[model samples]
Target: MSHRESDRRQFLKKSAATAAAVSVPYFLTGQNAAAADEQKANESNDRPIVGCIGTGSRWHAVGPNAMQLGDVAAVCDVDANHAAGAKKKVTEIQSKKGSDRQVDVYEDYQKILDRKDIEIVTIVTTDHWHSKIAIEAMKAGKDVYCEKPLTLTIDEGKKICQVAKETGRVFQVGTQQRSEMGLRFLQAVALVRNGRIGEVQNIAVAIGGAPACNSIPVVDVPSGLNWEKWLGQAPLVDYRWAKNGNTVNTRCHYEFRWWYEYSGGKLTDWGAHHVDIAQWAIGQSEDGMGPRSIEPIYAKHPVDFKDGMPVQDDRYNTATQFHIKATFGDGVVMDIKDSHQDELGFDNGIMFMGTEGRFLVNRGKIVGAPVDALKENPLPENAIAEIYGGSMPARGNAHMANFFEAVKTRKLPISDVFTHHRALTTCHLSNIAIRLNRSLKWDPQTEQILGDDQANAMQSRDARKGYEVTV
Candidate 1:
């Protein structure tokens, strides 16, 4: 074995041993354990104290949904305006619920982590900030509810998983498709698992392409915005703004996804959602199981590249169009691409095709020959119950409720971090293949790109000083 591989294996072994030493098993002996269990059950009825970080457009919905399950003790954002706005929204929601608790606002997230009273933290930060904050929060003894696309790079996923196992924290990824009210995703997974869809042959996931844009002009950093902290582990770049008509500086907020420095664009954005469900349905949503090979069949980016690195930093550099394919160990082929005119006839969603049946599923509907067959012979009750994590369909706030239940019981949630990391790794691999414009082989057990040094180097990136993410 190479020295690097040996070192990594040793580190992982040590981490697992440390985690085993710290983890408290579910069962304990004697009356003390019974008393402790009773105390925990009583505390579960009391509202959990929550703190929300990154109050952006998405958080407007996520923050309110979280409030339904917990008390909002604090709201935080790097931008002062966003923090204040979220604080006001929290107060309004609490008033409507007939609770008069006041919500605190902060420009720094560390203050929230420092508080002992906050039991849970909902992270809605940009793609680059997810793993760093999540690891720190777990170390601080706070359960985390992080948004999807859980890592900025493949190595970040491994770090987050290790820290979660070591701390035994209740870590939930925000892939709400798993708990959608109609259970469309769950039903599809159940059908395939129960042999309703013969042996799975192929899967297709259609996430739209990234946008192309000309170089944006650098502008003065806006007031009340800490640009340095916002750039956090990402490489430093001049602050740029969009010009409105003639002379208006619209500061960067939601547009960070288009840059390769900050995110993997649509590959990570929607891929985190749809590709995750595909992995779960195919029984690959676990540690040490992922795509064995990835190929970039076709691709186009907004800028030029040299050795897989984008040549320009000022333009929207992510792939604008692409068709990527991944092959698993069991010969299952997963084709991920932009909107394409194809036989599947789906513009957005997932499609599963097998010998006996085929089906298409999205947020709105699920249809196929297998579903039609289900009417004649309904799915077993146990199968349906297991898919919903032992709960029936149509439960209010099902995703958030599941996380809270896991927090109370110390059980893994439906979208736990380990499986989410495995799925996100597939997305990252697709992006890497596209950037390099070649086929690459992967070793899932070692978590490395095999026999290709250049591709292996893409597994991680160097963080700027003061923003390094270490387990």
Candidate 2:
């Protein structure tokens, strides 16, 4: 067999071995106990060996969810505390399943990638580190399940897609709204595609604004944290930490989202979800089909910006209040604003207005005339499943389950990177326009800002030496 085929066979053998070990207790407990509780711990021997990287707060959820579907053999984090906590968490979870699987912990993620037995990996690192690790993991012959806002820059998105196509690995972007959230987002898409809303006119995505902060105090880096590794791909900087009375902020961990150097702020944080849903529903999700021009109506930054770059590094520099209008080639306008009170009327959801009617949908509820009409007129029985790309499973943590199922079937998961790139491209452009304080004409086919050399240059940043992502 070829080297790749050998790797695949080895992965299967290890997975089968792990599965059999976990099944011994279930077998001894009798068939009645197994039948009464099918918590996936007793279900199948087709488990894929999983390795979780970046076990921070977010991975606490993503990792545990994946443990339910796969055999988690390892957990890695740059922070020692997080790595230990994740090991404890994984051990407790496996204990409940009556399986004494030893989950190895690591400070360096490369160790996890080097393991040939690991068939799948979840990349829940900060926004900037995602592309590099994911690319490396795919190169290591493993499937990837990564959190959304997957790319730190537009160019990174391009690189990721190239690697994904070359590897033909099953990659799932964790935008749960597409698969979960009561399938409200799916029903919204179905309603639009079925012409229930007629020809689409405009979509308002209401992802709230980023928080502004004063210059944070530079302090000693915390013990058990690798500041250099955590700031991968981004510029080197001092660890900043401050507690203003009750509110605590830092240039590390969860607070990294506020810095432009590390993340795209709220634009990508929340925009990744709302924009993906809007683009998917309106059929602008494919490549070469996106906004023709993006106009920044209003933008308020926490710190002054000079030529699209933040002047101050110590403070939160992302846009605090912004309204970006992206007009497509077909004249359909997508308004991405901070909140509904910005005059769009919905706080944290999408509002679709078409020639025939309009509707709004968020996580909590889907409302408006079009949605209300669904009760009496009703969507077709197969409408939701068809929109979802297949039959839907029961809705508890179905996104990770979808990833594991794709691992078995060798099919792409619902939230693949291809369309996510398209949606994130729009969001990245919005940030560019706001930062530059100018309208930009875009060529989606070329993936560049037309007639604007400086804006096009902002599409990618120079990665710090030794952290650069090279194929």
Candidate 1 residue-wise lDDT at 122: 96
On TM-score, the candidate that comes out on top is 2
lDDT of 1 by residue, 1-471 (tens): 764345334544543443343232233234354334434644665878999999998899788877767889999999998898998999988888677887888888999999999999999988899989999999999999999888999999999999998999999899999876378888888887677877678988889998776567888888888999999998887898876575333225787888777889899998998899888777666566788999999999989999889998777888888888998766678999886556657777888888788899888889888999989987897575565555543355667767776787787777888878888899999988989888999988899998889989998989999899999
lDDT of 1: 0.82
Total clashing residue pairs per candidate? 0, 0
- CA lDDT scores, all candidates in order: 0.82, 0.84
Which portions of model 2 show Cα errors greater than 4 Å? 1-43, 342-344
Q: In model 2, state the lDDT of residue 38.
A: 34
Give the distance in Å from residue 306's predicted Cα in candidate 1 to where it truly belongs. 1.4
The lowest-lDDT stretch of 10 consecutive residues in candidate 2 is 21-30
